[model samples]
Target: MRRVSIFVLCTAFLALTLSTGCGGGGEEGPPDSGTPYVPPVPDAGPPDAGPKPDAGPLDLAPPVVLSHSPEANATGVPPESFIEVNFSEAMQTSRGTLQIIPGDGLPNNGLLVARPEYWDVTRRTVRFSFPLGLPLRAFLTVNLANFADVAGNVTQGFRTFAFTVSDGVAPSVSSTSPSEGASSVPLSTSEIVINFNQPMDTSVGTLVPGGGLSLGTPSWTGNQALRAPITSTLVNNGLYSVRLENFRNINVKAMDGAPYLGDGKLDFGTGPDTIAPTVREASPVEGATNQQYESTRFVVFTFSEPMDTNLGMAELVDGSTRTPLATSFSGDGFTVTCDAQFKLRPGATLRVELTGFKDRAGNALVTTPFLGSNGALDFTMAPDTVKPYVTQTNVPEGATDVYPVEVFSSAGNPGYRKVFTFRFSEPMDPSVTLVTLHDAQLPSSFRNLAGVWSPDRLTMTLTISPPSSGLPPIEADKLQYLELNRLKDATGNLLDTTIPPLGDGRLNFRTLLNQRELNHACEHAETQGPLLVTATSSVTAGTPRSDVLHGLYELTLPGSGNTFSGYTRAQLITNQTQPIFMNGAPELTVTDPASPQTGIGVTLLPVPPACPSITHEARFGTVASPLNLRFSHGQQRLRIVLEDTY
Candidate 1:
């Protein structure tokens, strides 16, 4: 069995030697064409070293600041200079943090934070910039932290740098309540407010007022504003001045900070009015009697100066009752009118009391309640039962040669014909007061009259027009009469017709004659002598005598027949010069009788004589006399003397 095993091992060895080559160096030949050759693969040591995934290198170094402007511990740095920081290596640009804090060690103090504004293309350099400069004279600290590298390595701790900004400017005034050179400032300004451009040190500064101005202690607000109270009353229309001295900023420096050198003086002016107002005059004057108690009646007060209408109040007191009156001011503020809102008692004495009145310049009235006899405005109210009567009229009782139309184009009404105006003693009711015009040539039933009342209903203007039918136009050279019948006052009082002449509501007047007759009469009177005419009655005509009356003829008036107290004279001179007299008898002159002829009229020179003056002229017979001296129309030969008092 051993010999057979040896033979098997020799056979294996001989096969291996035939497949492997010997150690001798020799070139190999090509393999047989029947089989293909295969190449061997190289061995790798571990699975981890064969074709691993790509990942960046692990870095743990933090970023550092390379350089910074306004270096640490720097002084005298300009406030307008910008702060800059440069990083040493590339950083996580968005993750960096920087802080500039005030070095006062106070919490809640203002601070500045740095933000990166630029980065290089290589991502290795980062810079921070400040656009708006820093605060003046500020001690600031720059802190750097939270800066990370691209590999996620943050800064370990904070890096701090300290510096200071320089300042050479002084504080200045920004504004004032009443600016410099201001005018019309109120005299009641209680305080003055001052604003500064920078925070100030109020402990060391002083504010002084001049020009008779007084001020109290000043207080500071927010280190930039000061308020000073007024210590005394300011004068009206006065000038004042103020000044600031030794004013400095809160930031103290060596040898004391430089003081403000700008304009330190402030000037202003006050208002221009100060006089108090007083009552100058009043209507329905004090102690007045017969004052009508009607709606149109107003109690008016005139002031010495313009008043402040909004500030005053007035009231009307009647016996024990007090009532508020509606007050209104005139456009000029010089007159105040009071109207009663309630009905006033008849025959009662009333008083108007004023209070709290002031002028435009804030001056109170000199005398309260308008100082009077009893310290109030007093007037007696007229009884309502008093009858209304004619106070005056445009056409008197014996007015002659009066124009038919008083005003032709009145109030833009070209056709409005006003012949007569009748004024009443009190406001009358137009509904009850009736006016009629009666023509001597027209029938009694022919009524052709229209009337218009004044705004206060106290006067009536009569206009005459032809009737719509049957009546002819108003004829000239005829007698026209006006009758006011059934007249009543505003309070229903009947008219009092017991008075003389027009008091009975009757007025008689003669119209002018034709132009031809008037011309003929005027020619005849110019050639005729100054004839002697008789005076029969005060308001009537008398026949003429044959004797020529020349020179001055004096006539004494009786006391019981007239309101005159002196004698009157008639001067009938044709071509003589006037005679001047001194305190002699009142005289009437008749020299030129041809001109201004009305209905065959004779012109009387100085027609109305002056006695105790013209207001109290002597009458020939009665109160209503001497209206005109003329002759009857169409009767040139027959001369007559007519009344000539108006």
Candidate 2:
């Protein structure tokens, strides 16, 4: 058998070798003798193709903004400059929202209606154009959102920026002294003054003189005014002309870097000033009564012609004592104002005397004493004893149940009229009468109070407004007070607080309580009980029931009951077992079912009482007993007894 197998294997090996070596198509192969045979490995689908031909890296990052025109917070940008934005990558043009919002001062103060003009060839930049151009000197904001790349990645980074447009109005001259075609201008005028409509760049511009006129070095006072002094004496009855060349404002420039427009030539005729300056008007006219006596008081003298301010001397005289005044001249040299070095005595006749004064042409005054006959600039100072005081008020002292209709109300309400009117004994100085309104209950509570003086300056109408943030309002059910500090009259006399009624310059009044405020007070009286309740009777027929009920009573108002039930603390001492029911209206009423006499009938005068006198009545058998009720501390302490009729 072995021999036979060996022969068969030899024959198969030979056949496989011939077929595999000679390229014959045959599959005769076997392992040696007893070895195991294995099948050929399956194909791995074309050898993996070398990592699938490399598709490149993933695009997971967001797109970025590369740059923008009219850079962030850039000022003085041309109004017509196109706005452009460049992105780091090509972006989708139709996928974003662009808005241009004006910060201020434009017909369209809100969002500007504009659209992108076009995207560049690379699709990375976009430009926007406004047909009418942006408003001059306006602040604007450019906002962008949802700008995505072609790869579906939204843009990341700053999406909004602000810029300011340039001022476009050219500089021009508003006015000039010795105006165009002016005649009889003073030959002694020291300078040619030019006033610009706006501030100018003083570094540039020249004042060219003509008509035999020569100008000295020019000087500027606050860039808005230019002064060119005359170096040579001007000729009398001569014509003059001056041209302002290359003058421009600090912001005047065109987009092409061109200079802005400026004022043209100014021409005038000069005439000799032969007339002497004389006092034409005086602040305190001769024989004037009741002038201010304070040191800050000014005695002014207006001259008929411009004067040489440097050559002037004046004095204020009271009797034989004379004092020099600190004097200053008006800009045009047409008025001389004198300030007193010391406070003038009250109730004195004062006179202002000008000894030596000259006009611009060195002409002396015709008369030495310039104002009145013998220069009697005489005026009487107000007497210090004649002080201002509150004569009357629209709201009376200790007034109760007063409505704050005019004092405090919502806007547009007819009740929004003056709340208080204070009539003074004399005309008071409105500037120094610092009258303020405050809350009596809240010591630190002050209102936004304003006052309007009558035409005569004797009466003031007060209006109260809401206080600043975090402060309470002057609402209903409040005790308001008025305070006058540093209130003075025109003569600098202080307010007299020793007057009747408002003795301390203060007036207290109570506002009427609304339904909500009354309910709140009732709730507080209920929860925080033991309010003092004192009572007495006026019936003299039998045993006079004086102090009928005087004790701390626990109050209870159950479930919207406008009536209060009082439980006395000392029930045995009072010998009162039945509960006393008290009505909680403006006219309160008290009753007890167990009592034979009609229980105390309390009538609150003026509703919400502010130290108000109340009327009370009690009945026993056929006699009617009159009583008086008083509320001391709001509704905390109450008394019902016989005192005044009302």
Candidate 3:
């Protein structure tokens, strides 16, 4: 109506639709495409949002053989050939079936047992190989079935292939009965068996006996063997030869279908058995002395050859008395074991007597009883009844300053322990050597006792351990005794505890000063030193009565005219030396040749103090006691304190 152009009219209509209020909406703007506005129906709340539908089963296919080696019905295959199968698709090498069977419908499982499955690099192919060579000149069938693929697909059908192996090698004798050039063949030998290296044809064969030997009909005994019985009377003692013949016949060919290389032959001689079995060796050999009866295991008697035990008897003889022994023979009758229940007495000889024994050849052994000879065995039972005596001991009776082999405590002082060893004249049974350690003054828990036997079983080592509690180092003056209550030899003989009239297995020892300290203090001093004595100024003697410190001196009493009566005395006290504290009991020898007392010697004893005095009083004179001096009546007694040199 306003005469607007068509394009202008269309553009105005689009602009109006595109502008606000184009669609029938009350509050919201027009639709994006200029169409009627319609919502998505609230999304249907996630499209029904319920359980998912079942997926059902998957589609699978079976695996099939694509190709194989030695293709079906192939011929002239090697006897050791491997049967291979290639699948059409990848296969589960582990999940498959393979079988090797004879072409003929025989159920020969040996072939299947002989072959094991092997897979190629790709795993899609399987191979079967026989470790042992396959049967010769035979048609074999290989079957593969039920192989699976990666997609769970099993082969729909099985596979079968055939192959024939050609024969090549011939069979020959590997060994023979009566052996080649055999002699001394038993006249009673029953049969002769021939063994072939390779299996031979069993259809037909023959045996030709010659050289005055009569062999019975030949018979197949095994796949690769034949045996023939020797006619009893015809098997003479002279030399004879036997042969396997006619094996070259087609029916009698080897398993490889080849003729036998040559006839097998054996030559041997028959003779009567005459050699007797002798005593080849013996255990605890003849003349074995000091043998402990308790330590005696089974005695063995080895024979030169297999013996006949039908009438065998053995006895162990002690002087005129004979004791039967339980005897047993080894498998080959070449060894005999003899056992006895009673133990042999000490310092006694046992003679073994074996009689009525024969060899496999019906020959008898020497029956005479001989001493110190292989013909008769004898062993002297070690004199265990004499009782095991201690040849040496680590700690002797009344020992002093023994270095502690183990931990000990002495007057609150810890001491090193000493290993106590008891060496016996004969081997001892440590198990029965009851060793009890206790304080000499009183029974106290001052010991940690442990013992071991030397490898030779003759020395028993008893060691002390540190006390669990109480004192540590043992005191030097600790009195202890080790009582070996049940000391015994290997034969159970008790120890000679009554020797020297001491208590049974009781050893009394005293611990003294440490040896190292004592040795260091008296390194160069003679164990026994000269005693020196002098008179004090208050005395009538020429010199004051004094004791010398580690000194040698002379003492002279007042003499009327140079005839001096001299006496010497000294005391050494120490807590470090053996027999710890004591005085030197000196002996005096006058050197004056012209004097009446010349060459006179006397040993002086220091009189003990009457009370608790510091020094002892001693008098030297020819009184009731021996003395080197006849003192003048007015001579004074000397009171001297000597220095400890050790």
Candidate 4:
């Protein structure tokens, strides 16, 4: 160990001459030639922790320095470089006691802060690189007695590291935000925060885009500890550019392997640097239930652009007549009104055309005749269809009877049939029950609910037995008409539309002569086997009338999706009940306009009631002239009509 100490001292003496460069002299014999520093040995008297015994013999010595990176006078170190020293032996990792004081840049000037470039631990060397290699004279001074060795020994020394760049150059400057090849950017980037190598004079920045709408000059303001540039609001839905156009002329260039080492550096040399902001599709195509086609009072038009109202009435269309209804426009307006006489005939179609609406860019539309993909563009109005039907003529088509002597004819001859049926355009509620039987008035309590039939399936039968007692006390045997409004066809649409309605709502009859009532043997209801009876007299008024003298149930075929339009009066015949079902197929007939001579017969409606809505329809004519009654998707009901009445 003594021999190594001597060798170390010899090397230090030589280094002192190499850097100090002092000539042989008297008082300054040699650097580090002064009295050698020594540490005091521990006191042995009672081993007390009192003031370290006054000055025993100097026996303890501090560890000596071995080597350092950037050896003694290395040059061109980066700003982010570190300083490190190797002791004569292994030491502890104590960083707080170690530091490198930079020669340039103010304290905490966002530069030269903890610049630990990299550490070659295997070789015990630390280094930091500069933002850019700089060419300036910088110094690294280390304090004394900071770090200690495993032997509790520290270097009793203060050392300095200084270097100079031979050539006169500075650090390189680059901007990252307003990128070099960028064409469009934020025109109002208020903070132009630029990063520097060592330290920089950050009093240069500008903003404000103007003149031709390019980037404008930015106001340089060091706010919140930053070299910021101020500008106005950014362009809405468009793009603009920004640039470090001008600043105080401060120049800098990079040293080979270090940061630019110079002060007062700003926008040394630079000039200024535009993206188009696009349209996304419109909803509800042009001709949808749009403003023109929705029942005059229910149309609306919405667009993606600031609509121009000058184009006016050409925006929407009425599907039925293809006529133009004036359209009123508003930014947030969703509803509009139309003139009177707004109605669509049932079983009709319409077309909606649009070709003159303009966009915000004033570009006229490119598409026309836009139809609702859902097929709602075609709406039809129901036509007038209230015709009294000859539901059941008990007297057949022709018959007669004589009085007194010869007496009224037999049951068949006298045309004494007592059952009949009929239905109106719409249905009447049984709640408002009405009836007029024979020549007497009967109460509803004695009336039974009539059975209904499907328009799509026209034939039906009532499994009912009417009661019979005797003639009524009032009008006896007149047996004239049956009056009742308590009959409806599913939909609440009523059968009567007039204030007082039309005629007597009854069918006439005729009777034949030459027959007489047989006054044969007689038997009462009890004596007979549940008699489906024929009374000897008409219902007596003021008496307990058992049987319902009158009642009615109806069905129709002339609404939205039915099949009864375009047929001449002759081809239309209202029937008594639903037709027969053959192996599930219905046997039916209607006057098909396509073939008028003989009526058309079929098993199913040309169009069927598809679930909640009607798909197939009744055909009184060719396809174009068929009626369209339907079971609407939302309205869970079927409509009925007296087939030929429309």
- Model 2: number of backbone collisions: 1
lDDT of each: 0.58, 0.60, 0.57, 0.33
Each prediction's TM-score versus the true structure: 0.29, 0.26, 0.25, 0.25
Q: Model 4: what TM-score? A: 0.25
Model 4 misplaced stretches (Cα beyond 4 Å): 1-297, 314-320, 330-346, 368-646
Clashes of each: 9, 1, 29, 76
Q: Which is better, 1 or 2, measured by TM-score?
A: 1
- Tens digits of per-residue lDDT, candidate 3, 395-418, equal 666665554324334553434445
Over 4 Å off, model 1 = 1-357, 363-382, 402-418, 439-450, 468-473, 498-503, 513-646
User: Could you tell me the lDDT of residue 574 within candidate 4?
Assistant: 33
TM-score-best of 2 and 3? 2
lDDT of 4 at 172: 31
Each prediction's RMSD to truth: 29.8, 31.3, 31.2, 26.4
How large an RMSD does model 3 have?
31.2
Order of the predicted models by lDDT, top scorer first: 2, 1, 3, 4
Question: If the candidates were sorted by their TM-score against the true structure, best first, what order would they fall in?
Answer: 1, 2, 4, 3
lDDT of 1 at 516: 26
Highest TM-score among the candidates is held by which one?
1
Residue 278, candidate 4: Cα error in Å is 13
List runs of model 2 lying over 4 Å from the truth. Answer: 1-98, 102-131, 135-139, 144-158, 162-169, 178-180, 201-203, 217-219, 253-263, 272-646
